[model samples]
Target: METNEPNDGHAGNPFTQVPIEITISVGRARPLVRELLRLKRDAVLPLDRRVDDPVELYVGDKLIARGELTELEGDATGQLAVRLTEVADLRDGL
Candidate 1:
């Protein structure tokens, strides 16, 4: 049986603490089969996007947001991060 119980907040949700992985898609490469097979160490595979192009963030197969790649400063210097530029309306679902 199902009942429409009164909802409080995230504290009552079991999935609140569940971990999910978000993938940041920078760009794609479409190398030919022969070209792919000829790849070796130190070979540069060029992508379709420039360095400053916006990257897409995806949760599974769903695109959630778009952002730009940036480098961290301070104690976490050298670490790469994303600066969100656009976010999708996810009120309906993921």
Candidate 2:
């Protein structure tokens, strides 16, 4: 889903047009430093997610929502994208 920029003067200066980093978390793993160092090309470190599971969308370290991974349709880059499924409540703080 897309969010429209606030145009009313009520939404002021601090929230400028600057972009924020958005990270998609496929899953997590706890690999030791030794194990990580041993990893080289094609060494698959399997994440805690299955192929069909929904991934998390995070801003900074907070989980603001979740989404499903999808292919970028009609894009030559063949890049991946996410379609948001759910948005977390700000008061609940994830």
Candidate 3:
């Protein structure tokens, strides 16, 4: 049976216009309780990954993509940005 539902895919979906928040995970750090408590101002906490490691992008707890950290040039100089290296297929939803 013919229906009135739009056939234009997400372009016709109202929710597609909604905004979402993405979380970027650079790395993780594990420290003993005593070490955590010992943290003071200016204390350096080492992470498990190096600066060149690919960072993960997540929507809530689900990872959506991986990318490299980069600094914007020109007018937005010094602003941090992510250059996506890998992206998950989200056709089946998050």
The lDDT ranking, best first, is 3, 1, 2
- lDDT for model 1 comes to 0.92
lDDT preference between candidates 1 and 3, better one = 3
lDDT of 2: 0.85
Give candidate 1's TM-score.
Answer: 0.85
Look at candidate 1 and tell me the lDDT of residue 61.
Answer: 92
Candidate 2 residue spans exceeding 4 A from truth: 1-16, 90-94
Answer with 1 or 2, whichever has the higher lDDT: 1
Scored against the true structure, residue 5 in model 1 reaches a CA lDDT of 65
In model 3, pairs of residues that clash are none
Best by TM-score: 3
Deviation from native of the Cα of residue 66 in model 2, angstroms: 0.2
Estimate the overall C-alpha local distance difference test score of candidate 3: 0.93
Which lDDT tens digits does candidate 1 get at residues 1-94?
4448645454557796589999999999999999999999999999999999999999999999999999999999999999999998887674
Candidate 3 per-residue lDDT over residues 1-94, each given as its tens digit: 5557666565557897799999999999999999999999999999999999999999999999999999999999999999999999888764
